[model samples]
Target: MADNDLEIFLTARNVLVELRLNLAKAVSAGYKKGETETAVKSLIEVQQAIDVIDHASEELEELDEAEHDED
Candidate 1:
């Protein structure tokens, strides 16, 4: 493992957890149907989730590369 591997993993884990929670909240808040006013808010959350997922993926990939490089 690299020096920052733990930090990278922890960050990714946190982002993934937040993403799941946000998605759940959006669903629970009536983000599914078009008639609801919360749909827009849900869409914003979903967009933010996309960025969070991307960031987490990058962090994990960096960690993977570091580990493999050490092997």
Candidate 2:
């Protein structure tokens, strides 16, 4: 990957990490406040986001490998 692309990926990954952490905290607080339904919904969304990130990261790795093979 080009340097710029790598930088962008890193920045996105960092933002996702931060978001995940914040969501976790929110979930914890929601549960403590007896907002079970809302907390569960948020948790599900967080899981979905993580899944998308994982899929995208895997696709990128595959593309990188293919590029190396072509080289």
Candidate 3:
């Protein structure tokens, strides 16, 4: 648990939290507004957010492994 590692993790966590909140807002707004465009846009956003989180997870795992190897 180096300071750098902790900072990276917390930043990623915050980004994920924000992404989820936005997704929720998009879903709620799309449904309430009854717009097909909004629904499709939300779907795109969901995929993009998932991809980002997935990549971040992989990167973090690699970082963890590298840190352990150094020790």
- Using lDDT as the measure, the top candidate is 2
Question: Each prediction's Cα lDDT score?
Answer: 0.65, 0.69, 0.68
> How many pairs of residues collide in each model?
0, 0, 0
- TM-score for each of the candidates: 0.49, 0.60, 0.52
Q: Candidates 1 and 3: which is better by lDDT? A: 3
What digit string (tens of lDDT, one per residue) describes model 1 on residues 1-71?
A: 44366566566667756765766666677644553446456557656766765676677778788878999
**Between which residue pairs do clashes occur in model 3?**
none
Report how far off residue 52 is in candidate 3 (Å). Answer: 0.5
Cα lDDT, model 1, residue 7: 64
TM for candidate 3 is 0.52
Q: Name the runs in model 2 displaced over 4 angstroms.
A: 1-10, 30-34
Sort the candidates on lDDT, descending order.
Answer: 2, 3, 1
Off by over 4 Å in 3: 1-34
**Which candidate comes out best when scored by TM-score?**
2
